[model samples]
Target: MDIAALQRWLQHAMTIEARTSKGIIRFQHGSDYRRFLLRLKQNASSNTLKSVKPIPLIRGISCQLPAGLSLEAFQGQVWLEKDCKISVRPSPYKAKTMDNGIPWGVQHIRAPQAWGTTTGYRVKVGVIDTGIDFQHPDLQHSLLRGINLIHRGRPPRDDNGHGTHIAGTIAAANGMHGMIGVAPRALIAPVKAFDHNGSAFVSDIILGIEWCVRNKMDIINMSFGMRNRSKALLSAVINAYNAGVIIVASAGNDGKRRTVDYPARYPQTISVGATNRLRRIAPFSNRGAYIDIYAPGDKIMSAWLKGHYNEMSGTSMATSHVSGAIALLLSLNPGLPPAEIKAVLKRSMQPLRSNKARRTIGELDVWRMLQAAEKR
Candidate 1:
């Protein structure tokens, strides 16, 4: 978009923005971060906080945490003996199309609906998770240059199946087999921050978000989350939003009801909950004030290990579905801003349940969202 138009859109969004979900917090030692959060119930302000835990190595090797706590908190914390440093060197490689992996969601893609009238733009979407399988047949054409924000080494290439799977969901092509993506023409800028264990440092994801801003990606798909909140992480989202990037993230699989998952729960970020095949919300899909919309997440079909496709379930999958949809939206009109994209998603959403202040949003209707955007 041009300078004057960008300024006008920003000015408009500043006036109509809605309130953000609160009670955000973060802690690592995993399952134990909950009670530790209770200590800060009275002062959940975005201030410095701490939690201390014994490292188990020496039976009493302890680490200190932030100041206050008390409000449900984190899960999935682990201890690895190796201490490694990953670097941030740009990659010189470019992707080449292969013939093995199949498209994951082509049949239901909405891109063709607007084919006759649009320029069919290629949007830049950043996938900040495990590395993507750049050479996968279904993804190569849509893949673009990316950054490694996790291990100082190289974005730990998809030793784990998580990142690759999510990438396929966002931009995989449709000609071959598998299912198709919502936006097959979108370009992917993969940024890896987590290793196979689905584990990562808070600082790593922070660097990933910054990479998205500096690169000026149109959308960022974050399929990971922490039950804990970090000022640094939240700031990164705000910075990226101001620059026009839509941040979509998984509503952490905390198994709790109506909870706040960092990055996903961040005010500027879009949080996605999971739904099963029957169009019902997944029972284990975490819920809370932060959830912006729910999508088909259970047994979701997408690309996986060794350039193959399979079904997996998680809020992660749901997040990518929405990201892919956004890509389709941008493909139709390159002029939409991040905030306006959020508005389009919210307005197109059907009411799931109504609270005094707001109604929970459910699965997205891709065609409806695009139709609404065009009319707007």
Candidate 2:
């Protein structure tokens, strides 16, 4: 059937109680998978992909299923070809980033002083979150072409506003808007793996990391997490780290003592937690041995959706600060590998004694980090 015919059928199709419209499926790493894809490509037209081409990053293919076929039917067909792993995209989960009030986080981490050394110039930072507002004044010029896994043909646009805020924290320009990022000159590659509601599947995140690897991003910022750990997710993190990409993720907002969220807990990522102006860990920030660092995440002001600025708080905000700081490090030493960057950051942190909870490496100190970079 043709694209028009597929669309017409999609609009009216209902199978076993669910709308049979979209699907996300992946094949294992093997030759049979490639052959299957080639066959599918030969038989299918371009429009079958509602938006972008089937991404080679995670070896996953996304498309609107043909008319009269439910998502289950498509999965079954793939299963017939080879024993592989496949997952349907999950509903958007609640994210950790939130509006607090004011933008004091920058000074809390001493980013202004570090600005003299480097503003993350020439660094490529990938934000794997909700899409970004590329037209936002603070981010437009710094944005590189990004992919939208949620909506293929569409540009990675910020309908949810979370990704835009995170991007601003990392690379928003120091312009007339009165807002500045830790790495104001850094390039942002916004990979929209999550939907507007802040939820996404493990598969999308894997693809996002692969895209970052393919683009040679120096730092990839992820401000989302889940409780359960998946083997596939761990493998993806390992792949990115092995590729020399610095992976940073939020520790989550669960506020538990021994639990940090997956991807963050996976060791390959720098698990970040949130701290307030008082230098106390936020009540909502997750804790555990996996928590590698802390940063200002309370009442932090940055870019928002629809050409606006807002204050939000969460471990998500903290993750952005670390990402930007990593970018700043790369600016000074572009060849620094992921391990060295983490080491310098650890050595430079301002150790804090927190009675309220177990601390990780302590609060971020951009000025101190710069000093370490200089010596190296």
Candidate 3:
């Protein structure tokens, strides 16, 4: 079965369960997935593997394999396919926000002053989360045609409102009454990986990243994570980085030092933790060596469902601020590579006053970033 056919079948018949099912598996690449399927077909006589059906799916993923396939058998086969990584049902990071009269996130990031320089025009960003509200007045003008990886047949619409909030923070237009985003003119490419319930498998996220890479997105903001690392996930991040896409992700909300989430934990990506108006790290923001910087996330007001606004908090929100900052930087110097962009961000950050002596870089300084980008 091809992916579209399977998707059509799924849309009409069965729902893909989030957890406790091992029927779904994602491989390192399309060739690896195909090779594994070929092995299954060739070795159909084996007691451990009785099925040999084929299905082409997104980003090297194959889902809804024949029921009753042995997990142990599948694992045994993948263990030998050393070049490939296979995983099932990797959980998603939940959104873990503040306030100035001006909305602390924007003010703390110094976005208003930076807007005097540039509003991130011509910079395209990909928001990889639970879809985005393409029609929200505050964000409609900044959006590009995006894909819905969760339900491949549908338009990428924000059902859970998380991606909308994230998109608004990154690039919502400067309307009369709506809260302004950090980079108000940046274009958002909504890559809906997570379903409405804020849940997704690693495969879903990989597909989103793949779409971002294919479209040559300048930046990608991922506000979700899984505690356990998946090799396939790491490969996807690396691929995007190599393609010159600046990737930013949320440090998980586990509130623990030395335990940031994967993709965030991956060194190629910039991992962000949350801070508040006082320049103090939020208690819920995970810390450790993996956390590259902090940004305003507490009680942040941004576009929500149905053209409304709401305040939310999390490293997820913090991640969007950094993403927007990168967009602004890219708008100034579109040629800046991921490593140089990260270095500029680290150099321009204002250290959190509350965490003095720890040398932690606190909130973003968008104005400073603008100055630095101009030199490039």
Candidate 4:
């Protein structure tokens, strides 16, 4: 079935379940599960319910139905399933020249000033993106064992340069050869949810989040978004937030003033917009009251594929900065919950010089944030 049509059907099916079911139907192992599957197959009047896979993380199921089929007729058959549309890709970014020493973004956020207190030692950040260049020298020591959801039982290696770039910005080592990141000593667990083309299913992302939480990651960096909201995705985000895992997401590159992207649009996420070295919001950044903070994203330098370095500009890069900053905070106060960490981040923000009216959204000041954390 075409993705768009499948998405519509899933949305309608979920709505019907929400209106009629007593609560979310939780599946169990053994005979009950087998019986449920058997019943599902038996109820497939048109044989459209090809597969009904369970996603235990969100306590939902992914139903595969035929395209253009009206879900209204089968509402009673799949009342327990809350399926959603799939596929969201990483934001578009620009490539620029390479640089040495601390990247301008790292300096702009004042991450160096916080290093004296904590270099995010041992803090684990879960990066849900294309994956990482595990062989990159700068990122070699900074990486921990991570999963490749796209390919089971394989390393989460980067084929596309996006995830490696994001990882480099978050925790590339402070070695002699390359640029350092915001939290140079922090550990990253690369979760390969998106593929080489940067596209990923919503179900894959939900699975990535479940992996991060179960593995006890201190933070999650989601540098992607979908314009339409997914109830299933939101449920996963909420579960991660309640598990004390801070999630930082990109506002998007739509260049709109009114709204940002889903996952980031969710209240549980620390939504981020892109800013340039001029301390002004990047023209490509999606800005709105929903954006929690801004960070250096324009022409930011970091690691790429093949142990090389490249510069990329997007809210994705900006989100990495925030994630690294959170690592610094968590390294200092390991017990701080997601809400309090977000509060400290907001409390230490510096007002942007470009837009006076946008008092609600400001640039991230890692040094200031760490100082505030120290006092608390």
Candidate 5:
């Protein structure tokens, strides 16, 4: 299982699909590669690194998944471990960043369509990530009381630029005054869990969920993820779901044909995938049963620090769009329960097939979602 040949084979297979999301491929190459992979696994020791002998490095990416069950996919691409399984991590946020300056992503707009109806209805949305820059003119306007849950004894400043980009997508100010968020009227309750590294632990995320439940945040947006599955994170999400808060998360960036990242893949969580302006899923967006919705993510331009903006992309950004949409729905019907909100979102889904839209989890008709909530 040569990594270069596998990538080439995967690339060739991907081109066959009429629908391509950000260059991801489903392995139509049959079991030949799988058989080769099996052989590699059989010869490998407790150390797949020793079995492979040499590890090829992906330029600019300093991270590596261990050999063995974790790096199985890496066999074909020197980047992967020798026939080993890998825990998912970081996601395409780093990979997409490498693409820098692709025009496919533009700044998300603040939802005037939503504000014209309800003024956020006294609801609050919690953003679990690096702390928000409360002083930023665009975000400060709608930010509520935020918490720094990082136990590292440092303030939640977004040095990695991941949190800032996500915040802009969820609730940037409306109008040409700045980039508009999906739900302009919604207030964001910032929860600083990930530090400047754009990484956080499951324990920290669960703790953030508890904080959200305590603070009564109506909706929670989690744009970060861990590679390993944790019972703690799942329990916390279930608890939050029971507490009447809507949680939206990214599907992850593993680039795998079938597997999904946890939290997003958590059965009840509303896992989101990324789509471009055309509404087609992004290539890096992980797909499978867990994916529930799609939104603009590829090459998206959003608020960045230092009075700037960036063209960032990931399912994380896509999750923010869905969160913003939830915020809009919440604004229209302020008292809607969490389950009711989920139901309305499902009912109002317009269907993924559209002319303007090339792809979608399903079309979510915001106006219709609000109408249903009103009747309920």
Candidate 6:
């Protein structure tokens, strides 16, 4: 059917349904719908029907439609907005007393053993999250100049503390006075895509991925997730992967048995799930065949805002461990591709003690991973 014919049919069907359903269907044949149709026609006339206007970073536009409108009628013609959230626990614990040594997560993953071989020197990790605390002593030397997508003129500094925590997990470096990270020598480039509230649109994330690719980042650490899939986000991820950048993402905190979140669900990313100190899966971690590996994420202490430390838990923490582990691998062999790195990671994992039935997903062993890389 032609576009106009389809629209008329949808309207008629919606109106009929609204009348028969006795208020169950509230079809608003108002300016919103009119504007949407008008934009649709404008896009079609310009031969850019699939692309959303004004926002070049996003490939699709989202709008509310009448309840009875058939989605199949506009198949392949409409794109909806997908909301993304930082994958973190609901509550974060403030560290009352400070400890001066390697964090438990860093030690749990056996990162100290690999430190003798490579401390991930010269590796660049692009963190696309809220932002980072540039003044934090543990992160000051480990941070590189980064961008702020939320405020173009300002620096990408942490406002929500999520990015700072993620950064500390991957690359915090304070030898004597504070805690060290998994890849203490690695540099992190903060890409502020989310706001202070830790909420982000898929477009901002896509833009962040573009920046990482342009900056030639060795690893992209994505500690956020969304339930719905965005084609534009997936495309950006594939492009980054093909550009020889390894992307590590959280498997999500939904605690679902068989479902993972995107872009973690996307095959190009190395999906990580949460594991506690006991080497068992965390209760909040999403698990399935898509989880590439597990890492320590339960009550793990890391850098917070204002040069302090705190304990947080979620698959986001798990993802940072994997990203840091990859940084160590890349420091040894910078030429290794994403596929080979993923293979080495998978082959070097240790079996989880709690969930043995699903042997497909295993816990990360950083020392073993580096050893495996040497053999390759």
TM-score of each: 0.68, 0.79, 0.79, 0.84, 0.67, 0.80
* Candidate 2 similarity to native, TM-score: 0.79
Residue-level lDDT of model 1, residues 1-376, one tens digit each, is 1323322332343234353112222333433433333433333452322222222111111222222322221122321121122221111223233343333222333345543444225888888877887666777787877876545566336766778878887777756554456677778888887766666665566667777777778899988776555554665677778877888988866667768467788778888987665556677688767788887777666776667666677888888888888887887778688778888888887555334324546667677787789788
**Candidate 5 residue-wise lDDT, 198-259, digit = tens:** 66644456667877888889899888665556544565687788777899888886655466
* Model 1, TM vs. native: 0.68
lDDT of 3 at 147: 95
For residue 95, what is the lDDT in candidate 1?
Answer: 28
**What shift in Å separates residue 61 of candidate 2 from its native position after superposition?**
5.4
Model 4: runs farther than 4 Å from truth?
Answer: 1-52, 69-98
Model 1 misplacement above 4 A = 1-120, 151-156, 351-360
Model 6 stretches with alpha carbons more than 4 Å out:
1-95
TM-score of 6: 0.80
Residues 1-376, model 3: lDDT tens digits? 2433323343332243433232334443565667556655565575434422232323343343334333342342231111122221222333322123246688778888877778899799999888887768888889898998767788999888888989989988855656678888999998887777777766667777888888989999988877776766676788888888899999978789777887799999999999878888888889867788899878778887777777788899899999998888888787789999988888777878763426745568888877766665
Candidate that beats the other on lDDT, 1 or 4, i.e. the better one: 4
Root-mean-square deviation of every model: 15.4, 6.9, 7.1, 6.7, 14.5, 7.3
Error of 4 at 304 (Å): 0.4
Off by over 4 Å in 3: 1-20, 23-59, 65-102, 355-357, 374-376
Clashes of 2: 8
Model 3 poorest 10 in a row by lDDT:
79-88
Give per-residue lDDT, candidate 4, residue 109. 90
